[model samples]
Target: MNKFVYWVPAFIWIAVIYYSSSTPYEKQDIKPWLGDWVNLSWAGPYLERISFTYNNQEVSVAAQGIAGFIEFFIRKGAHIGVFFVLAFLIYFALFYTVQQNKNKPLLAASAWAGTVLYAVFDEWHQGLTPNRTPYAGDVLLDAFGGGLAVFVILSVHRKNGRKKKFNIE
Candidate 1:
């Protein structure tokens, strides 16, 4: 892969994230989230509600076993679950930024590192906001999501992830 191929998209995503996501953290007017970006609130809640409807009792049971554990940490001003899922998606979606390259380790590390850094910056951006305050728990949740993405990319696809081999003879 050409250096420009990877770097360009990397920079573009960074810029897009920096401009779009962080600013919202800095000033959560809610009009956007409530009126224009209402989809933000709606989508997140919708995903959860739909997931619940689909799973029903199984979700409750699983939540009681493991997901319910999050209750111990959740509180006002911090939505850990939302942040986690958002991070997971951000990282996962970002995977499309680069085409497959020869350097497996580098590519994996870049994807993960970008995710982790994005989480940190997102929190910092939130810190600058008045209505929204940055929470360490959120950052941790973000990291957890990012970490999960790595596993997902590796494991979620079974028959599709072809191993690349280099001829060294």
Candidate 2:
């Protein structure tokens, strides 16, 4: 198989991330959809008890109401999920395209590095888009997602009895 074939998914995923980042937040708001799909009013009292500040903004049912509160978490979770998948896809591409004997740790590191760099770029791109505020916290969340992917990959390799030293030197 052509090595380039291994990279198609990663490239496509990158495009998806780019397109999502390019959209204005108003178009991406999910509160109305959530309101249409589910009844969260029952939890409003409980949600109202939860209050905190994030990125200089209040995040709670009191600040955003039930639907907005739920949407906040959903959007943050999407950040983690999308980047998690991107990291794994990047690792998959690197595993197939690199020399067979290349160190797995190095490959994992490279995948994580790529994910972080892309997250930085994505945030920067979002900053340029109207109604989008780039938060460093989101980038940290993305890095955590990529790190989780690396951990899962390493754990899987260890479970498969590879026991390869994880040194990146």
lDDT of 1 by residue, 94-119 (tens): 45554566344454455667667776
Rate residue 7 of model 1 by lDDT: 51
Question: Model 2: number of clashes?
Answer: 0
Compared with the true structure, all predictions reach lDDT values of 0.48, 0.93
Which sections of candidate 2 miss by over 4 Å? 162-169
Clashes in each model (backbone N, CA, C under 3 Å)?
A: 2, 0
Worst 10 residues of 1 by lDDT: 68-77
Task: Give the top-scoring candidate (TM-score).
Answer: 2
Candidate 2 residue-wise lDDT, 1-169, digit = tens: 8899999999999999999999999999999988999999998978888988889999999889899999999999999999999999999999989986778899999999999999999999999999998999999999999999999998997766544464432
Tell me the deviation in Å of residue 23 in model 2.
0.3
Model 2 lDDT-worst window of ten: 160-169
Please list the Cα RMSD from the true structure of every candidate, rounded to 1 decimal place.
10.6, 4.2
